[model samples]
Target: MIKKSIVFAAFDEEYVATIEFKLAKLTEERASIEFITDAGCLEAFLERPKKIDVLILPYGIMLPHPEAFSKTSIYYLTEEEMDAENPAYIYKYYSVKRMLEKIDSGLITEAESEKGTKVVGVFSASGGTGKTITALTLAHKLMKKGKRVIYISTVPYQDFTYYIDDASVLGTAFCYQCSINIKNALKIIQDEIKNEGFDFLPSFKNLPVSYQMKFSVYSQIVDYLRDKNIYDYIVVELSSELEADKLVFLKNCDWKVLLTTQDKIAVGKLEALLSNMLDFDRNILILCNRYKYNQPDFLSGAQLLQKYEFSEFIEEYNAPLDLEMTKNSQLFDRTILCME
Candidate 1:
């Protein structure tokens, strides 16, 4: 594949080097990077440019003539007000990952790449169904199996303070802000994120502050993440409380894992609900979570993939999965096989 040419320029050589290293790591060394440490060299290079796909430079430098690099998408890096206002200005103060994400997202659709991303939506009709735990365990297992995995949580007022330490890790919120112009915005679903060696956007600050905008910002981000071909598996943990957003998100998933309790009395209602709503998708899988050996597999009319009874805390499953250590590997492997 022909890699895109990216030229990043700044006055500080150390800062530029950090960005270069981070960008190369993030892109898997698939991008061609050119750095300019001297303002004189940058100006000289701008005098006669080649087929550079993207140009990002300090906002302090005077922008080159528009016709100089006609085919290039130019971005100005700024710490404060720009010398000249432009839509392509990127905040210099943001983290290196965030800055690179903004740059990468700009040209997301330009490259023709194959996607390995498979979205798994963990949802439940009712709460306390082990939805979040299931999602996290699945992500951990997939990571152990050598699949690039990310977990996203959409619970309102969530605080994974320990998981995400940086208060400045505003990936979800920043991605939402970019989604305001969803049409012009790159067709990416989630901001490229990492936490605890398990990729994820941190918990939301004031989740979905705009209802007038997209129904669920996450609904689109997951789809974008898949199309971008970044990760192999994307496990999303959604709140059972929000039905409308759940519906919107499930459409993008390759496999939908819906959890429910062993309530035989709720059978008729669940059958009608799953049939009327989720029956449209063949990939939907229903599971009776926290099940004993005797709990009915077909809690409703749907097929079952029940989670065996467990006494250990959910955190016990945090480390790399050892198939010898547990029985849930059966569930994890089955879901992965379907995705593969």
Candidate 2:
């Protein structure tokens, strides 16, 4: 049986939380729920990137263009008296069970999935170039703006758990081994990784396990997440070492961010690497981290861009060495956010 997909768009956090809590009681085999609290995100979601079986919005919230979502069945939750003749109207502040009953009565219909999610891959030629930091910071910034974002680290030696407390290392690995459906896998992820503000899937637990899993399995997991239409963005932090498997995975991403430093050796490696890459201009952005002016020995930003013939090159300002401090700085606001 196909699981019913439901989306709740509302401005009240408490109301959203209550609905989420109650929905968690339902079996994953029967239903899936996605919540949207941001107005912008709600608007984007209503665009119907994917088929939404039911969309719940509070009556007070203004939907600028109702006709645009004529394909989506909309239900208004109102505390005051609603049009008794309108079957789409549900009494607000009702129990979760009652609300779900209204949904089950066939107020909305489900359709096929839509492709709208964008996957971004952050990669570097070498370690210690702030690839993971950049990925996490970008995800955080998007999440701050009320976008549904998830971070996935494909590094063999997992360090993402250390930086982000309560992260579920090898959560995806568990799902893969169990051969769980995407709906159940998503539920497991939401339960395992809690209170992190955003979702994160860490690398494998050990090298042996990592080697045992094929690259195709990794691709399948990412593909399933992208097709689900649950998240707005998937930011991936890849390993520094490049292999055929890694390259294939990176190529599938919607966007690629190549991180590098001013070190001559690093720039040389990057230049040599980019020479053999095909279609490097499309959806690719090169970022020079820890940038400084009037540097000697190391290549300048303009020099690096000219040598590589890159379409887009950005100079990331040097920020505090501390991770927490760096996140609050202008680095992400001014540099990372500028990217599409």
Candidate 3:
């Protein structure tokens, strides 16, 4: 069954209600619709603007920025704005909608790779190594390059959404709540490549009960994405508990980065994780997060490399994690990579 979504936008209270009534009629046919009036608040509107297929901007209200209306299709009251001496309001809405339609339609025929999306997946030995922070940093760095990035986290907490300055959550975390079988999930992702220019798909809300059962689905998704050659990169912030099937999913990436610290406990767990993956790829990069220069007890990456007999497969990077800097810098119009 094809489920439809709609957004209702207008200023006049009675007119808004009338449109809502019409939207309700559409819902009788199983359309998923939402209303965005002065009451719905801008944050709420922006959070789910795509749900609105047709946006009916009402008469008489003035907007502060022309850019605000760019996310949807617009229908304006041609004479209502003129009568109220706010022709600019009508003009702005029309302009924004027209431009969005142009880009949206162009996406249908456009090639995916030309759009330039970079995706990087961030994994860690355990929970506290700042995996989400690192993933957001990679995304922020790419966005700064004037490239589009979609940041997604497989972990339940999903702190990635907190770091994005002007970002919106793309798909629901509880993907399984919908009709998201493994096949459909992969299809939606590939379909969005040309449509959204660049976007991210977070892990399903509930990890399937049996890891082995999910592989065929994961493989299908990865194969589709790899074959399309669309995104410059897709960053996956992985969960801590490493499973065999999940590791198979990791191998599909261009780079499967693992973050670790010099703490004996941390490095030990990372070693164990890598040792278990006998077929681990060569591209695995070991990042030493929160490096301490003076603490001799805390081994340097090279020293750890020599001690662990992992000098062959692991390349270490020393960079201290700065949470505050990550938060503030993430807001700027671009993404930056700081190597120490």
Tens digits of per-residue lDDT for model 2, 78-109 = 76446745768876544455466666833223
User: TM-score of the candidate numbered 1?
Assistant: 0.49
Q: Please provide, for model 3 over 1-340, each residue's C-alpha lDDT reduced to its tens digit, 9 standing for 90 to 100.
A: 4544445455545334323443344235445556565755744665544434445455543444436556545545443224334322342212222322332333122222234333355788676777776776666555444455655556645555454443444355234423446665564564333212325554343344422224445445545565576545667777787777667777656566677767788878877876777566445656656655554434354443542321111122364444357544422111122110
Candidate 3 Cα deviation (angstroms), residue 178: 6.0
lDDT of 3 at 234: 63
lDDT of prediction 2: 0.64
lDDT of 2 at 265: 80
* Clash pairs (backbone) in predicted model 1: 188-224, 189-221, 189-224, 189-225
Kindly give the stretch of ten consecutive residues in candidate 1 with the minimal lDDT sum: 307-316
Candidate 2, pairs of clashing residues? none
Query: How does candidate 2 fare on TM-score?
Result: 0.56
User: lDDT of each structure?
Assistant: 0.60, 0.64, 0.49
Clashes of each: 4, 0, 15
Q: What is the C-alpha RMSD of each candidate to the true structure, in Å?
A: 20.1, 15.3, 20.3
Write the number of the candidate with greater TM-score, choosing between 2 and 3.
2
Cα lDDT, model 3, residue 95? 25
* Top lDDT prediction, candidate number: 2
Residue 153 CA error for candidate 3 (Å)? 1.7
